[model samples]
Target: MSNRDYSLSDVVALLVESGDNASTFYRYSDDVPMPSVEVLSEIVEDLRTVLFPGYYGPSEITPDTMPYYIGSTLDRVERHLADQINRGYCFVCDKNKVDRCQDCETRSRNMARAFITKLPEIRELLLSDVEAAYDGDPAAKTHGETIFCYPSIRTMTNHRIAHELYKLGVDIIPRIIGEMAHSDTGIDIHPGATIGRSFFMDHGTGTVIGETCVIGDNVRVYQGVTLGAKSFPKGDDERLIKGLPRHPLVEDDVIIYAGATILGRVTIGKGAVIGGNVWITRDVPAGAQIVQSRAMQQSFSDGGGI
Candidate 1:
């Protein structure tokens, strides 16, 4: 082990050899190109430009020039998105040999076009989210401020775009897109989560919305709120089951305050108010208010009983 006895060539050869120990971490294929985080990040930015024209990408957009700008941006987005989708398809095919896709190019193009078709609807939903943020927060001065300054809108925009790709069957790209937003905003929303319009998250930091969560319209949540699973169901083989409804189902007009965690497939009924710093696992009735008992006692002691 002395420095004089060490051979650099031997060390390099030893590391380059793909033995059983090294096989798990290596991909030996060169036929399919891997997806690039840098390119996908650019694609997400271009899409955001198309989704909100005046805010991102190009700044000066007039009614006469908007169509040209949108068309050019969408064209670029579709091309890049198709390449990433094809990479995702090739990756899946390399992993699972049984159900290999023959024509990833055509499939990727079709999926990308289908996702593009969903842009108008996605923009409508995002506008509702912007309106929700403006109406729900007293500190918000204008809708433009929410669109430009709020992390919730940025996170939701990424979620909505990624959700469409998820539905269109573009596999790894959607999760990458979601993770990009998560890395940027500290709000983790799974692509598989079904969230309705007018969703607003105020001070949305450290919030985790698990897959299989179904949230209805006009739902407002604060920072440090978690909508997660209570337990994992195991089969006879002792492996955890996949794709089961494990997360909570939140109904319309629900307001979850900061530092609250709702677990399991329980329902938070319509018009229910979940107070701050509470943990809920069971279903709350419609119009019910759930809070900490100590907070309730303190409220009553202060002559502010509910």
Candidate 2:
């Protein structure tokens, strides 16, 4: 071993040199104000309080004070969310060329207000999801329990909020919100996935729903299920094409069991039951049951079959 002395100053200098490299994906200067995860987390908490009322925020909230509490929380959420949205816009803006004169603050405020207006609808969808969870899971005692305790509810709540922001064309912030949920729960759902009402994920861990997936109403899925792409298409320039519908299309009343991997742009028809540990890449007809074939028992001298 060669003896070498390395000071903290030397390490700092090396890091500075690496950061100054133009080939690296580094954000500086105009990207001074990036979307903050801390602020975004606080915004999520405030929004959750607005959505679930007494379940998330203060426990002493009476019906009389509920309206006031919700209003105040919404006001805070709007202000903070608008700021984060503006940062997201600024992060992507070509300040030297296209968006130098863009009114990002105004646009962000308008987007935040638009998201606030849709809270009632988002709550309606969440109510449906809560009910679906209660009805689907025999262990669930009440819909309130699902709202208060279930990771699915929390994850879905974040997804619903993120989905709205994605629809409103706000970038970065939605993904941060989605990732917050994913960090808490093992479920990873892309913000771009379009999901209808009454969706329930039983046990919920390790479930991955990809971008461009369109899931219909009253759909239920178990843990370890993957709704992913089969393959990625590339352009003539050798860069992988994006924004294409590569994920599965799950229809109404479909039930996907645990450990099932449904890949590609395949359509899962209405009322279909996908069995556990099954791998599917093609479209299924309505009212079909897809399951793994029976395992054959064979005698082996070396006990390999066991």
Candidate 3:
């Protein structure tokens, strides 16, 4: 075979090798399915349409037709989400080699129903988020524009749905949902993070909110902001520990500028302003403004040597 081509035996060998490697890098099991990224993406779109009626929803939806569209959209969301959630449950069970996963479908249905019920609450939070985005940005033309055009809204919409699933204790699917938005919007918000009302990300890109982050209400963060962990504890076997609160606890009304990395379990107090490119590891008191230090300039007389 040439360098650009492969023989039949070689292709079969490559496929067999990849199948073997799946046990290490991926999940694989017979009779059990994994969560489909395409299905999850569809679910997100349906939920978005249901949440923001008349925006991405049916064109004929009006005061009388709203209920019909909402009901149908929610039914589709529940069906698709329940299937994916069941697959997520089965994926975990298969990984742990648990033989009893017969109840996964039931649990998934219940969780999906619960999540569907919370759509109104999620919509309310998103509305407030839209208002905050409009209020925070000077260039915003209207609240509707912010809702339809802002990347922050897109990120938060995905986050809110994923967070609801996370809170319901569903495995694998929440993270996948969060990543879908991250891939599209360049905002990396973990589903495990808890964000409050009126949260806004202005010019949001290169923003990394870690898994354990707890952000408060009315907080606005600019682009390239990282609310991340400083370090993670390791086990005696040299495995990194999980579930510790490592990311920052940002309180209400705090503003973190671009490229500011606030690490550890430190609390960013209410009303504090973190300047751009600042590396913060300690707790900040309320109303504090952290900025880069002043630089000193030295004038040289000699052109030949230092």
Candidate 4:
């Protein structure tokens, strides 16, 4: 070992130059690939436009050709979704077994088929989300704007779709969907979080709903709200606990305002309203309104007192 032909710095430089950064924009490496958000977003746009017709994307949807248009759009979405899913599947597959792709192909088909089968239900959930946003926000004139512009709607839509995939046991795909929306909207909703019907996240930004958080129906949350873990549970080896219910359980009709961080297994009771910037670790009674202040104000009104 007199002298190395290539120094450590020289090897590092070569590695960086050969990495993903050196690739042409047209080509992407699966080893460190960009989530096909641009492609998937277009798919979602087309799919949503088809699903809700005049209420979501294109306004030129005609009654006579509505069914035809929807069918065509669904077909295209299915193809596009399946293609990307297959790419993801193969990417994550054993690099050495790339030639044995039967399993990957089957997985992709099954995943795509399951997602396609759940389309009607997904649309129903998204329909409620649109209604919730419209009713919650005064500026939302119509569902069209909510679908197009509202960050909450986008985040929830991605969560709902991703949750479905997660339930189907398609790993990574769900995160990709959630992260895609997160990149665009600045809202972080884990697909594993359980959120019930008629939920509304008002002016949602910087909101983080951790995995294992259970949110009930008619729950409303505002911007900068976080339902996170009180403390990380570690194993005998001292590794942080996994798959535990670490976040808050917000019951039906609970309203949490901006900048509120409700941690632990605490239950914000049914019809409770949590005000802005408050950090809560304990359980709350039903129909209680906890506002921010030195006084710890309680309005005694369920949810928003509405």
Q: What overall lDDT goes with each candidate model?
A: 0.90, 0.88, 0.88, 0.79
User: Which ten contiguous residues of candidate 4 have the minimum total lDDT?
Assistant: 297-306
Candidate 2 structure quality by residue, lDDT tens digits, 19-136: 7866344666545487899999999998888889888989899999999999888998999999999888777664333444357789999999999999999999999999999999
Better of 1 and 2 by TM-score: 2
Per-prediction TM-score to the true structure, in the order listed: 0.91, 0.92, 0.91, 0.81
Where is model 3 poorest over a 10-residue stretch in terms of lDDT? 297-306
* C-alpha RMSD for every candidate: 4.0, 5.3, 6.0, 6.1
lDDT of 1: 0.90
Task: Give the candidate number with the greatest lDDT.
Answer: 1
The sequence of per-residue lDDT tens digits that candidate 1 reaches over residues 1-306 is: 776776999677666774547645666666788999999999989988898999987788998999999998899999989999999888877777646677779999999999999999999999999999999999999999999999999999999999999888787998999999899999999999999999999999999999999999999999999999999989999999999999999999999999999999988889989998888777877777778788664553354222
- Residue 51's lDDT within candidate 2 is 88
Q: What value of lDDT does candidate 4 attain over all alpha carbons?
A: 0.79
User: Which prediction has more favorable lDDT, 1 or 3?
Assistant: 1
Residue 276, candidate 2: C-alpha displacement in angstroms: 0.6
lDDT for 19 in candidate 2 is 79
**Candidate 1: Cα lDDT at 31:** 77
Model 3: per-residue Cα lDDT over 82-165, one tens digit each: 999998988888878888566778989999999998888999999999999999999999988888899999999999999999
Ranking by TM-score: 2, 3, 1, 4
The TM-score of predicted model 1 comes to 0.91
Candidate rank order under lDDT: 1, 2, 3, 4
